[model samples]
Target: MKQREFLKKEKEDIRILMKFAGIYCRENHSGEKVPFAFKLFDIKKIERKEIALCSECTRLLTYGLTMRLKCPHDPKPMCKKCETQCYHSAYKAKIREVMKFSGMYLIKHGRVDMLYHYFK
Candidate 1:
């Protein structure tokens, strides 16, 4: 796929993920809504990135695999949020590579189930 097409899909995925994250946060954080700052970050004027991660896993729950899901080794391992933010800067690259590999594999094997299984 062209870069533009991939970016469009990525943006849509980010939006959907942000919505889900917002809902989850509101339910968990004392029934208090998550602030806008927490929902999405503007990586660029045209591109946005969702910073959603499970409080426990710190895993990126929104995008297929993105920079946000890193295990940062912060001083306070006691804090769930801090634990999630530890920087594995390579996480995004790893995820992108895996996704690209899967795409190529799917083109050859044509199995939708592969994607479904991973998402599930």
Candidate 2:
């Protein structure tokens, strides 16, 4: 893929990852949330610059984003459909939990547009 397309994909994936982590953290965890410092790459274009997540959720989000950035696929396949399993088993399970909870919450809360991606 071209650089533009790759960057677009990165931004979208980052947004989704952050949103899922934020929702899951807020709903399931309790603690003082701190702003996550992005150390892998510059995310200036990502709108949510100050995502405050619990330590556990922040670690999960950081792992997810790292996997996304290092993905080997040219046109990245969704992790669910990909043949190569990049995430560790623990993180994979945690992300699945996050996706399930947040996806359902979004749909019930009138984020109808998320339905396609949720089912896709």
Question: Could you tell me every candidate's TM-score relative to the true structure?
Answer: 0.30, 0.86
Deviation from truth (RMSD, Å), model 2: 3.1
In candidate 2, what residue range of length 10 has the lowest lDDT sum?
Answer: 1-10
Which residue pairs come into collision in candidate 1?
72-86, 72-87
- Give the runs in model 1 whose Cα sits over 4 Å from its true position: 1-6, 31-34, 38-120
Looking at model 1, which ten-residue stretch has the lowest summed lDDT?
71-80
Off by over 4 Å in 2: 1-6, 115-119
For model 2 the local lDDT of residue 112 reads 63
Top TM-score: which candidate number? 2
Candidate 1 per-residue lDDT over residues 1-120, each given as its tens digit: 112223443454444434444434433434323224323334333335433333421343324224332323422242224546443456445444445554455556676554442343
lDDT of 2 by residue, 52-73 (tens): 8999998999899888888999
